[model samples]
Target: MKNARTFTTFALIALASTATALPFDAIDATQAYQNEVAILEATGAMPSTEPVAIFPAMPEEEVAAPVIASLQDVSLPAQPRVGAPAAVGVATQGREVAAPSADIALPAVDLAALAETHDALAVRKGEDGEADAMMMLSDVLFSFGDDRLEPAAVALLEDLAPELEGATALQIAGHTDAIGDEASNQELGLRRANAVRDWLIANSALSADVVTATGIGEVDPVADNLRADGSDNPEGRALNRRVEFLLPDAG
Candidate 1:
């Protein structure tokens, strides 16, 4: 009974020593126990003190605190807003010109209305003070420096065919610029008027007897033939050289 008890005590001490020497995941637990048994036999007995810490095990994962970055202070230049006026110098024809001010107001003009008003004032009046509507065709519509009709002039007469549908009596008159002699200008004017009258009779519904052709030369002008400095006014001359169509008032 005494030998059995001694063997049991040595076996339990060897197990405790093996468990402390080797880890729980040791590959050869039997070999470690054997080693412990041999040490026990040699030393006879170990001191019964508390077990000391051995190899420290590492954890699976490590945690760290998050760090935030700080922003730096920066300076930027100012930018222009939309619709802001920016001054810029412009070169025109070898000369530097100042741009027109945005604040300046220009007078408004209606060209179509002005033309209608001018034609209305030039209407021919009858002997009894009654007047009829008149149309003025610029000389530019005809060939340059001649009485012969241009293609555009012929087209213009064709367009007027609709307006002459109900007209029974028509009078055609022509004028010239101040640049030419009176006698020659009058003859040229009469020829132009006759050309217009003949065209209307042939192409339109108007009768030859109903249309009378005449010439007033440069006696009447809608614009000045000369400029303020006595220079020839091309615009005024152009306006003066024109054919006038008149519908005489009923007798």
Candidate 2:
């Protein structure tokens, strides 16, 4: 009976030892698995549990606005008479008064000579005699697509300045051909008229208050801009591109 009891005690102790050893082995295996997983993560062989950090978006750039040019204010002047008859000396009708004490001799006025001397295309007297006289100047006075007066034009203006010495008022009107847009042509005409006006005021005896500049643009063309077949007419266009000077009689 004593030996049997001792054998039973020994069997129980061995079973407890075996159970404790099995639990230690299982804990070692779990620790090794955790270490391997940590190595894989550090070496970039496995993905991380931490949320991926996002990059901030770049700021957008701002755009700049465009610049625009400012134009000057210009006003139109009085329109000139297109066609008018020349003044002729009237003969005394039904006047038999031959008792005139002394024969009055008047100097004949030569308009053609006056126009040529002033370098003007034509000089026309006003119909009402009280209106302003019109003098037409060709576009040859300025370069193509330019507002500046040529050297020859300056010389011509110098000759013409004498006529404006006693003028009460002067109007400079610029006209352009129909080769460009109306707005551009209008601006060009205004620039041309301003150029002429500036020259006259600076070089001539005319005052700024008495001188006025205007742009007629292509609206007051003296000739056709296009032919019957819709082709361009260089000659007519040249004629249309002109500057007119209107001078009122001296007070």
Give the winner by TM-score. Answer: 2
Best by lDDT: 2
Q: What C-alpha lDDT do the candidate models reach, one value each?
A: 0.64, 0.66
TM-score of 2: 0.50
Error of 2 at 124 (Å): 6.3
TM-scores, each model vs. reference: 0.47, 0.50
lDDT of 1 by residue, 68-170 (tens): 5444433233364588754444768978666676555333222222235443224433456644335455554567568778887777667666565455567
Candidate 2 lDDT, tens digit per residue, 86-166?
333334784533334333433332333456664446654455653233445556688888998988888877877766655
lDDT of 1 at 186: 85
Q: What is the C-alpha RMSD of each candidate to the true structure, in Å?
A: 23.2, 31.8
lDDT of 1 at 241: 79
Candidate 2: residue 89 lDDT (0-100): 34
